[model samples]
Target chain A: MARVVVDVMPKPEILDPQGKAVLGALPRLGFSGVTDVRQGKRFELEIEGELTDDVVEQVRQMAETLLSNPVIEDFEVHVEEHSVAEVAASEGR
Target chain B: MARVVVDVMPKPEILDPQGKAVLGALPRLGFSGVTDVRQGKRFELEIEGELTDDVVEQVRQMAETLLSNPVIEDFEVHVEEHSVAEVAASEGR
Candidate 1:
């Protein structure tokens, strides 16, 4: 099965409290040098077939309509035939 | 500032309703070829200095303690000196 990955992030203009909270908590936890943080979402779709344009377009529509809020977020889609686990294993080689 | 990216995903054994909802909605929206979906989170940290090992380790700790739940999710950290926008622009070249 092909793996299609969708990455969604709040628009740069939007305030991200979760990210700010993490950033604020970092120094308190003894981790320093972090100046900013932005939180986002990622979706992994396992498809039964090839990584075709039709499939990619379909996934894009999904992102626009359901996976993300277009007014406040922007997203990107990545298509791969290998699962992320397999990709990580190969990278370890 | 350097950009640190943390990618967090649900354990393979866990259920992902958001992803399932999207997967289910695809065919209803006239999009096909998708079989499954898994959703996750991504964090982008802007650091004030270099992408050193110390910073990477701190970010990893943050991921373990705050960005994700170790019980149900796994996370990966990526350190880049260039911001994502810069990287995307360069890739557009």
Candidate 2:
């Protein structure tokens, strides 16, 4: 199996209240050196077979269509090759 | 400058209400092939210097200390080497 990773984030021009909340909480949480924080979303998927470019494109379409708000958010997809042994080792019972 | 990416997610055993909420919203948003969706947080840092192993470790500690709830969330940090040309090309006006 292959590992597919998706990262979704609000467009730079958009106001991300969730990120703002996290940024506001950082200093109180004891992070001093941090001057700014922008929050986004991540998704990891274990596809059932080898990762091909076509599959990656399909997932990207899915992300654009339903996983993210294209009007305010953008996303990136990363596909990594994983051997069956690695997949089995990573799997949880 | 180097780009430091941090991904934070709730521990497998912890309840992630936000992820659940997003998963619930997917179907309504027209994502049919998706059977499951897990949501996490991402942070992109544009550090002011070359990314050394020491800086990566320091950022990891910061994530553990203030960016994530150690009791419930786990995080991964990825530091990519970015050349000045690539960095300049990627910069937005």
Candidate 3:
């Protein structure tokens, strides 16, 4: 099966209270130096077969139509690794 | 200045109703071939200085204590490119 990851975030002009909340809480928690924060959404989609450009385009359409709100957000599709387990085990990112 | 990205996702064993809702709606929209879906959080952190290992560690702590709920989620620290503007411009992911 193929796995595609979609990352969605607010547009540059939008205000993200959730992110702001986190930013405000950072210094209080003893974590400083973070100047700003923008919170977003991550979607991991599992496909039944090989990943192709067609699948990417279809997923892009999904992002445009549903995964993100075009009026305020932006999204990007990434061919994710096998799973988060593997990602945590390797790359460590 | 530096930018770091923190991605938080529900644990594999956890129930993701939001993801399920999206999955259920996918086929109705005629976008098939997607077998499963998992929704997560992505945080873009803009820092005030150069990217150092210590900075990465600090952000990891932020992900643990603020950006994510460690009990039910897993988070990763990634050195993000300058900005989402750049991601949207190049790589396209």
Question: Each model's TM-score?
Answer: 0.85, 0.69, 0.92
Model 1: lDDT to the true structure: 0.77
Pick the lDDT winner: 3
Give the poorly placed runs of model 1, Cα more than 4 Å off.
A80-93, B80-93
Instruction: Supply the TM-score for candidate 1.
Output: 0.85
Predicted model 2 interface RMSD: 6.3
Reference contacts preserved by each model: 0.67, 0.26, 0.69
**Model 2 TM-score, 2 decimals:** 0.69
Evaluate candidate 1 and give its CAPRI docking class based on DockQ. Answer: medium
How much does candidate 3 score in TM-score?
A: 0.92
TM-score of model 1, chain A? Answer: 0.85
Better of 1 and 3 by DockQ: 3
> B1-93, model 3: which lDDT tens digit per residue?
888998889988899999999999999888999999999998999999788899898888888788888778888888866565566657553
The residue pairs that clash in candidate 1, if any, are none
What is residue A66's positional error in candidate 1, in angstroms? 1.8
Clashing pairs for predicted structure model 3, backbone only: none
Candidate 3 lDDT tens digits, A1-93: 988998999988899999999889888899889999999999999999888899999999999898998778878888866565466657553
Winner by lDDT between candidate 3 and candidate 1: 3
Q: Is candidate 2 or candidate 3 better by lDDT?
A: 3
TM-score of chain B of 3: 0.89
Provide the lDDT at B7 for model 1: 82
Least well predicted 10-residue stretch by lDDT in candidate 2 chain B: B84-93
